[model samples]
Target: MALSVVGVVLCALVSVVSSHGYLSSPASRNSAWRFGFGTQTNYNDNELYCGGREVMHSQNQGRCGVCGDNWRLSEPRPHERGGVYGKGVITAQYRSGQVIPITIRISANHGGWFEFRLCNNNNPRARDSQQCLNKQLLTFADGSRGTRYNLSRSLRGDVTVHVQLPPRLSCTNCVLQWTWVVGNTWGICSDGRGKVGCGPQETFVNCADIQISPKRGFQKPTTTFNKNKNNFLYPRVSLVASVWFAGLVATIERDLEEDVLQTVVFLQRESIPDQDLFIRGGISESLRPPGCSSIVESDPCAIDMNTNLLGTIQHYEKYNAWRVGDTRLDWSGAQPGQDVYQGIPAEGTPLVWTTNNVLSPGYQELNT
Candidate 1:
């Protein structure tokens, strides 16, 4: 009599635990239940796949709540590894274009077909973090659609399944969902009167969070440059010179008087043996000078320069015309009449050019 009583109690306990099923191999969020942790099972609604119960049913009386649309029991939670359920758990990692092994623990197999779905955590439709609900069916790496794995009769104990991830399916973090619907039940009422029936009408859902690594041996395009290229050799100097020359030309021709004419002349020479000099000049309203116009021109009708001059001689490796050097020229005012022009020289600086307004026309130049 004692042995018979013990056997009955064991069978009763197994019946209570086997009422629902969950993913066991990939370590689901509900794994804590197997070790005497987590909330108690509510047999009335067995859709506790992601640590919560489905409060609503689909239009065809199928399972809901996995998509986070209508979870009646509790709010959605993060589906990461290592919480109250397991120890030092890491998110399951898999590679694209590989076959993944799946194991499910069925307390009492309700005789159903296993269906798998994948959700990209990065997708905008995902509600809870790392939870795979409300996503469309996943496609395998071989370009074939992933459908149901049908079972003819009730299956008890642990069941194993294999799924192939599509070679092109790439995601950093993802959720893999497994749903078991009892055979021939279609997750709907067995009787036409919309009443729940036994056997094929039952459903079990669970999920596992996973990370997908990209395929190995993939190469990315690279950019290359040659040292002998002109642009690569003196990129900064070339850029500066082009910009400066454009600004100088624009300044010489801007805002000319209706009747006044403008002209520009550029002279380059290597005749003075081993020396290169470039001279650029143009005529416009004397109100404008190439480099100092902004400071000196305050009046709209200011006097114009008959001859505007700009000269450059490259000597130093870091030479730039805009910088102050051993020799500097200062000019004030933009009116047609003679304006102040002063030459300040430092030691060892050679005289390049000078001008005396009294000895020339409206503009004067003395070059050495």
Candidate 2:
């Protein structure tokens, strides 16, 4: 009995040590951050098989959260009030392809000023690129009405913002919605009707799978996100310039907080990123590398581990390879100019189809 008790105590001590030293270490702190990545797969059987065994192995298949097919997801945008009954919701409307304007309205009360914002995707750490319209005040004291602000070109698409107000003023009759005009009407609109404006319904299509009611909320004092944009309380991204790179591979399944773990290198800009960059779900469509012809037909936005991990890898030596025991390699590299399967050249050799026999399941690695 004493021995068993001792063993249990030792195990607990080891667990604590391991968790602090490795699991919670700066390098591995949030390695698996993703909103619903591990939920399930949505792809058909055939496509799942072709993508490789890793994707096919998931019992849920590609149906997991909003990772595939849809480039956006739905999350409650919270507003705050102190002694005031009304709550504000920051609504974002996507216009053109690159621009999005967000608007906030007070509901349930009126009068006084409210501060609101649109945070970074599920990853608050990703909100480093965030931009604010300003603190909005609606004075029902004078019987005026609510307030609205339009985000500039810099603050649009795949982003979030927050708004706040004081007490006693019940800001009411406010609704958050989107507007789509027949011919190019973009930007935050005062007409809070869904008749073309944006809302949870306009988020990523995959978000439809998960339904949320009364999508807005009151920003609590202990909120997981922050109100000030300059505090550096968000996620940090670093650049390893010169080498081509692609998707993120997580060692374990993570929650919404983990969504900021991935990194991206826009093929168009060969520069090392300086500012903290924010990215939503990766580009859904495939792209070819810049200056490359169509015959190549590769995904431009892919995550390439071959060139990065090639030299140091022990069991795996070749590029775009995968192995059974390997824990990493979870990203999708964009192959811009060449056929995705056209293996990386060896000594200037022409691109050739990689043989499956060598890196086959038990002994092989792949370029997923």
Highest lDDT against the true fold, candidate: 1
Off by more than 4 A, model 2:
1-110, 119-368
Superposition error at 85 for model 1 (Å): 7.7
On residues 42-94, what C-alpha lDDT tens digit does candidate 1 reach at each position? Answer: 23333353222222333324434452223443434222222222222224667
Report the alpha-carbon TM-score of model 2 versus the true structure: 0.16
Q: Which tens-of-lDDT digit does each residue in 119-219 have in candidate 2?
A: 11211112111122112232222223334333332332232332222321111111221111111112344566543233211111001111011112221
The total number of steric clashes, by the backbone 3 Å criterion, in model 1 comes to 11
Give the candidate number with the greatest TM-score.
Answer: 1
| Model 2 lDDT on a 0 to 1 scale | 0.22
For model 2, what is the alpha-carbon lDDT of residue 181?
11
lDDT scores of the candidates, listed in order: 0.42, 0.22
